[model samples]
Target chain A: MTSATKTLELLSFFSEQHPEIGLSQFCKLTSRDKATTYRHLQSLEIVGFIEKNPLTKKYRMGPAVLPLAQIRERTVPRKSAAKASVEQLADATGETAHVSVLSGTTLYSLVAVESPKHSTRAIVDLKTLPLHATASGICTLAYGPDILTQTAKQNLERFTAKTQTTEQGLDAAIQRVKETGFSHSKGSIEEDIYGLSAPLFDQSGTIAGAVSVASVATRFNADAERTIKHQLILASRQISHNWGGSIPNPIEACWSKTLAET
Target chain B: MTSATKTLELLSFFSEQHPEIGLSQFCKLTSRDKATTYRHLQSLEIVGFIEKNPLTKKYRMGPAVLPLAQIRERTVPRKSAAKASVEQLADATGETAHVSVLSGTTLYSLVAVESPKHSTRAIVDLKTLPLHATASGICTLAYGPDILTQTAKQNLERFTAKTQTTEQGLDAAIQRVKETGFSHSKGSIEEDIYGLSAPLFDQSGTIAGAVSVASVATRFNADAERTIKHQLILASRQISHNWGGSIPNPIEACWSKTLAET
Candidate 1:
């Protein structure tokens, strides 16, 4: 990797749980020499990508991300457009609802909302959903560009026993998503979590992302699944319209047929 | 500059007006060689900092910023904590209200809210507020670290005739802010915008940011300025408490004395 990429990669190590990282901690996280990691941190710090806490002397995300995010939202606006729909989906389904956007071949989680009704619920925590192992990923592969299928097939890392690890397994999953206009994953990324997602579209009239509902597997009965699927379809439609697109006629027809059968 | 800083600098060129740029456009914008710019763009694209529009082939800020913004909000939470207070300030002052955070020697605009009451209200558009020409920047220099004063002195670019372009002028302005626990700038950054700001604090018991009201100069009478100052003090206290800080005893005493005189 280029030094630039390595510097950018260090930013990915930060999250809600681990917001601050010291120089030595960065050394351990990236498995790079201390000098190299410190240099990378310095580069990021100079550009305002990261800042050191005055007390702890640990690095956390800096203010520069805010303007970039503002520009991104003003340009694309997918996250803000999907927010209300995802929140409504979570409220309606009493589960966790999230939206993921497709950039290149990767599925990046845009936003997630967990319902307050349940004590135990699924949390959508992954920054990038693995294409072969998550419902949103499978939905994207089924509906997005053909290049994504090749990308997914190349990195079919097995996460759980239910994760699709082979080309054939992933193809079957994609086919199911294509046929039903929805994707389902049972214990794919984690045990006792069930994910249901429907494809969202943008102004290009092509798949742009997915709106999903994740529920506790133990409570995911047929009625719950039916409710979640219905909510997912509503969320996808609303989000697509907000993004200046609509569910394609074929996907709408598929969803209608699948809902009737369910 | 290192290759990494050069690569990250490309992101700054993107704004609300120029959201997307082609490789040629980037080269022109940065005044760098086309090949070097292309390599920098490639490194950025690899890490999802920028993505090409499928049709336009121009690059814009990508999904990676959303996650980093999320982490920053989760860690520092200054924006969310200050949002309500700024909104209230705008409502009370009938002007544009904004919050700016101090990162190193720079004052970064965290969030801004415009009151719909006026059709020709001031708009806080810039990402970084200049220390010599902005109320927030002057407030930070008056109350934040001494390093900021030196930094502001080094680069006092004049934005308007009223801008403080000399060390003595800036020092005089900062002295007034330090005395009153408030900062005021009249047509400093822009021709007809009047800015009033009060300092905000974080848990570190130091000035973290400032909350300000930007008013159209024509409508900024004595009554309006007094109302804005009163509202700013309220906002500063509320936001400081939300950020796990309080107005220091001396600043509180200064505000009380200043308001009593007003």
Candidate 2:
């Protein structure tokens, strides 16, 4: 790598897993001499990309990134971050794919994409998804804040007969979603729709939203469901990463187990 | 500067003033050739430090900074960010220096430093500063949210004879602070403490807190006041920059006019 590229790569090392790095740890991580690593670090420090902690004498990310992150958010909003990932998920699944964000306890649709491969695929027409009647809502209740469960219970609007209209049924659905790492709803919100979803997270490491594939019920089979689940995982990972978060290990393990069984 | 340093300097070029830059603008700003500037931009883009707007084709900050900023806040908390600046302010002004943060309508002291220049110095003993009786609280009322005015009027307790006890007196004090860019109080919160404060901002471009230098009443004179104001401006700027903000232009102009008059 070029010297500039190498210096820039040093920033990527300061992540959630490793928030601070001492000079020796930097040297060990990069497999470089202390002098070389220190020089690169100085370059970053001079530009306020890295700061040395006074108490621990370790280097951490500096305050400069806060303003840069603000600018990035203004220039490229969260909706745009998920647009490409949703498009890719729709293309891969040959069905309708969408991303939703939770504000308070309500799940709002951010963006949606539909595949050209399907002549009559599911269409996303709702602005806000009911917390107890959709796959995305179930995924959110399974992973989001505890208060969301109370909110979901209070608004158990029955969109269809299959929708969980009682708190007991909603709790059961949420329990299944927690175990499977994917939420599934058959004819819940819509009579002809089968929705499968995975939770999305943001920098706060909490469940920020969900990514889902809503397919036509008649076209949904065991093979299609397996394919949709795989693509949903990819979409969830991509969207979460784009939003500056990663999938938690437990959810990833659940997906692995569910895929193994599938 | 090394090539790495030069490339990293490119990140500093982005600010609230110039959030986006075209290729020609980058070349002009760095005084480098187009090819060299493009190479540096490419290096930053490869590491996700800079991203080009697909429509405008102008480069702005990337999503990577969000995670880095989050990590920075975790490793080096806001209290730590203000600690060094407050210490420097105390040393420069030879007085007690402190920072107060606004949460909702209440202002709470974050840190305090005593210069040890005198046998007797002002002590910051309060956990929460009264909104109507202290220089730091007045500074917050001047620049913080409008609801703060109502909050201040609701509880105008008289601590000392010079404290602004009436609504009209509080309004006059706030108006003067807005015009002068500094808040001043003589024996308001304490019997013998003279407090002068400047507002501090954060990445939100709003008043997050105030940096104040509290002097002993007997030690306060015109010369000491002038020197304290100068140091207060520096402390405010440093603390605000450390908190990922800059002094607004109008506030900077107000400081300049006040200093020039003094």
Candidate 3:
């Protein structure tokens, strides 16, 4: 990799998971010559991104870079929108509801709330996902903007028994998402897991991201598909509207599907 | 001041009150030439400390800077020792309890907790104050490493009506802090507010910081001053012990003062 990319990679070493590292360890981790790592560290230090412990000589992220995390406290983008709509989705279906948005190639949880009666829960980490398998990712791929075409071309790792691996099958699924204005996958990402997702469009007319209510597939069987599909579309429309998203004639789009909700 | 000091002075332009600044306006605010200001911005940006909006060109702090705030979130430096004691301080006083540690000439907040009672709310902001009048600053001034002698010799901004301008008077106050192991002030640095503070040493026997409880003097008068002082010193000692700081019998030092326990 280029020196610039290596420098960026060194910066990534200071993640929330591992906020501090030492000089020798960082050099070993990056597989850099000690001198190269030292140079990058010096450059980073001069600019105030990373700091060394004056007493210990170990490095942690510096005080100069703290404003970013504090602002996330003020603005969790689309989180409020997702919470409002996901509740409605759960009320309609009696299943867990959550909102996950694409971050880099993976998905991140904005926020999540469960149905009042559900006994089991979907476990997840925010902003960590394999792109090809998740319902929210599939929705974005199918009806997502031009970006979906590129993601599908990358390695589609099969994570579970029902993961869609073939490029043609994934394309067909995307086609289905376009037709239905929502996406569904059962046991595709996790065993026995079912998810229904719909895109939340922004004012710029791009599919900003998606909202999904997930549960075990047994709770949402073949007989419940139409009802669940209708709820997903309605909830997505509500969220898009609240976020100042311009979804022109959203109800009319739902009418194009076999749903009577429109 | 040198260019580096001027660059440090640029921080005065940003505060809890006004976090965002336009580049053009920042040039005017800093009184630095456009090229010089641009250079500062470039250095700041390179460190991932700040980011400018591509469209608006307005600069707010960047996301990569959050770990600095995280360090302060531990609330108490030595959690097992300090956390419970500090909470007791807040409960006893019905005011905000704060601990600020020296970061060069400036003080940085390590922990802050609001009072439990809604009526006696706290007005604590993590803004730095000069080491001249504020009780915590005075406590640190009184008991800090010999650096206080060096700092006071150089930069002592006369901040308030209660601010001590003369070196001799300030030295007496510092001598009082070292002797008494606590500091008290009434409407000195800020109007209508009174504060009690005591210094805390770390396990290594270095001046770690000062813990303070502040309240409106109207509720806590000269009669209540004895009680506030009592609580502050006790809490500070307890927290210091928690920090593994064997500060030569701090609790005994509190007993000698007229500050009575309830």
CAPRI grade of model 3: incorrect
CA lDDT, candidate 1, residue A250: 91
* lDDT (tens digit, per residue) of candidate 3 on A1-262: 4343355356667544566688899988988888878777765565444666545677766433333343422433457535757877878777777776665555666767677776875654545545578778887776555665676558788878799898887888877777767777777888878887877765334566777878777677655667767677777776765443545465347545557543
> How would the docking of model 2 be graded?
medium
iRMS for all predictions?
7.4, 1.7, 10.9
Per-candidate TM vs. native? 0.41, 0.93, 0.36
Model 3 residue B106 lDDT score: 73
Regions more than 4 Å wrong, model 2: A166-172, A260-262, B15-19
lDDT per residue for candidate 2 within B1-262, as digits (tens), equals 8899898788878876688899999899989999989999998888778888776899988767777878877777679899999999999988999999999999999999999899999999999999899999999999988899898999999888788899999999999999999999999888899999999998888999999999999989999999999999999998998888889999999999999998
Q: Model 2's A-chain: what TM-score?
A: 0.94
- Please give, for residues A1-262, the per-residue lDDT of candidate 2 as tens digits: 7899988788878876788889999888889889989999998888778888888899988877888787766666789889988999999999999999998988999999989997999999999999899999999999987899998888778788798898999899999998999999999999999999999998778999999999999999999999999999999998888787889999999999999998
Interface RMSD of 1: 7.4
* Per-residue lDDT of model 3, residues B89-155, tens digit only: 8888778888777766777666777787747555767577567777888888766667776686576
Q: Give the 10-residue window scoring lowest on summed lDDT in candidate 3 chain B.
A: B72-81
Instruction: Kindly report which residue stretches of model 3 are placed more than 4 angstroms away from their true locations once superposed.
Output: A1-76, A248-256, B1-262
Clashing pairs in 3: A65-B65, A66-B65, A66-B66, A68-B62, A68-B63, A108-A127, A142-A174
Which candidate order results from sorting by DockQ in descending order?
Answer: 2, 1, 3
lDDT of 1: 0.87
What DockQ results do all the predictions give, each relative to the true complex? 0.22, 0.62, 0.05
